[model samples]
Target: MNDCVAWSGGRPVEWLLTNAPVDKHWCTIHATHMTAEEATALAASGAVVGLCPTTEANLGDGLFPFEDYAGAEGNWGVGTDSHVSVSPIAELRLLEYGQRIARQERNIAAGTQDRSTGRALLEHAWAGGSQASGRSTGGLEVGQRADILSLNENHPVLVGRTGDEILDSWIFSGENTPVQNVMVGGKWVIRDGHHEREEEILDNYATVLRRLST
Candidate 1:
């Protein structure tokens, strides 16, 4: 982790001499706190800040410098580091809400092209998550990997909405409606929010927990 700080801290000075971009290929976890200079240098390196918002909130790690990071045009993505909360919506909501609380502004993520805050966050997660995973995906566009989430449009939260409102409701409204299904690599791993082998998986997990406790 010190290595990350060292590299982030030194990038600006180093960039002046080398004229080469610092890599985002292997950066994942970041030390929770970093100096302004370090954050600036790291952002200059084209690295995506790996943020697990739920975990960060639970651990009381200080918030990231969203405005500063935004000013630096830093890349960012989400993760489920501790397995405590795995829902994609929860992570994204926490991410935006955290920023709103820290920056004291509404729609703190507005950006060019992606004007809606929700859309921008989705785009960032889609692009940066794909990059972090070393997979080429995150959109429905042609030639991209087939990863998609299908929602229940008739759900209460989604009723009477179209386009960005739907997305905004999903991320900002604190709805508990689970993902109806998930397709990853053109295969369905979750159907109606229930895993394909959920019962068996839960049984096995319970067995392991029992053994660990005894």
Candidate 2:
């Protein structure tokens, strides 16, 4: 489960395809070297692929075949591996941008007619991430945890945006975080764009960094 940077070439994919326990085990195949056939097979096997675009690019990993992965109807989600980037928005932005650059096309991640690239990416990632974590999350449902985010409507990138366009603007155009509030399990952990324990958390984090540097 959640194998970091599991490159998808050579024998790794084959082994995973043949040996991975069904419905109980999933791999986070980095997929930089993944082939189309391998992707299709992984889709058929119902394995989850973890695409960490920020870390992959920082480490010079090859571009993932995102279009092919989507075409095969593969299960996938974004990750922020290695602490290089922490925001889910940035991870998503880079994921779509990488695909656009490689294919020289706009909205490569849309994958279907009338689908918003941002919304599609968000839903896929949320679903796959929920499955990976074995949680009843990823959507607002009757039994799921009450995890929610409130975007800042007044943010410059969000002006005049609505529906899926809001997600698109936040992912592709916003320079700063647009999440104004966050709640988990019916409790507000973040409000007015500030974490509830920000000051104390930063103080402890700085102490640890100082100790490590010494």
Candidate 3:
């Protein structure tokens, strides 16, 4: 898991930090083999580890040592690296679940905040992903990009939830998402739970699958 030669040019995290010759972010993507020294060095380097728990589990990759890295105040973000599951909920849910299973303890990602695990996951992932990409995302601030996801607050799964509870429900709940609307770059792309080109996109996808099968 900590195959520095496989992932990088065998540059240790500390060397990369002081020499500034390579980006350490690529080396820690799945730091399963990383030592405590490497973890601390990468954490101090201000690089975000792009974690894709669902894909990692799907491919039987060794579980990441999330507790140790997080204990070092490492920055991380979630992703769907292999497109195994496109839903961010699935990614986040698995990320936490994997840690819980490995440690035999629940709420491993929440740290000291026992009740707000989901909230912490969402916020950190959002912020880390933004930082990694160096984009003006991850917030609703006026100058930020207008990428917004609106959940159906009236959905049965979230009916009585409030505040971070709503976020928790949307992420940890089942796959049937409550996202009824989406806006990207200040334009409405999906509304009332339907994309404008939903049928066309499906047809095109089906055509490609059919051709590949033939």
Candidate 4:
């Protein structure tokens, strides 16, 4: 009880599950290092399991019980903790592979009819990411956030792919900067593989990091 209370920031998961503010969206972090019971409890509370794949693998964090979570129809998403890597595909593949290595089972993460583990991984991460971030994104289905990544189809890493294969290649293969463009908040943030404010953004970040170090 104490752990659950403390884990939930003094409020019980039941409270969050029932009385979550309609206006102020909420998401839980560091949902790793939990028991199966705790994981199930969190799923029941409508919290998205925030998976940080690269950091987890780097730090040797054990595999998350994604199978159990998915069995419960739990919401989940990904993050770039430590920023050591930044690609949705790597995140997804690492997540699934972690499960596979643990269970020594294939297709344990498919979750439902007609769902490939790869596709499920991508959909869950992207959609749950937007939900966790209090935004509406993840696809081109209309009326969602304009934040989008345009892949370089001609890139060798992405050549000879379509559908889930494109996503699979993107996640598994070391395809970098093949992202030709990105838009955020209905504006072009990256034009021709460069941030519109690249120089300024980099300058500000450098300034902040240097100041913090001293």
TM-score of each: 0.83, 0.89, 0.87, 0.77
Worst 10 residues of 4 by lDDT: 15-24
| Alpha-carbon runs more than 4 Å astray in model 1 | 1-21, 111-114
Give Cα-based local distance difference scores for all models. 0.75, 0.79, 0.79, 0.73
Model 3 root mean square deviation, Cα atoms? 2.9
Could you give candidate 2's per-residue lDDT for residues 1-214 as a string of tens digits? 1342355433656556666664435756586676788777877777788888888888887788776777888888777777658878888898888888888887777866588989987988898888777778878889997889999999888889999999988888845878899998889999999999999999999999999999
Q: Using TM-score, give the best candidate's number.
A: 2
Better of 2 and 3 by lDDT: 2
RMSD in Å for model 2: 3.6
Number of the top lDDT candidate: 2
**Prediction 2 global C-alpha lDDT:** 0.79
Off by over 4 Å in 4: 1-25, 111-115, 175-177, 203-214
Looking at candidate 2, what is the lDDT of residue 93? 90
Report the C-alpha lDDT of model 4 over 1-214, residue by residue, as the tens digit. 3786776654454444445542224576546665566567777667676788778788876677776677777788888887678776777778877887888877556755465666767788877898798888988878888888898899887898988777667766764646888888888888788988899999999999999999
For each candidate, C-alpha RMSD in Å? 4.0, 3.6, 2.9, 4.1
Clashing pairs in 2: none
Error of 2 at 16 (Å): 1.9
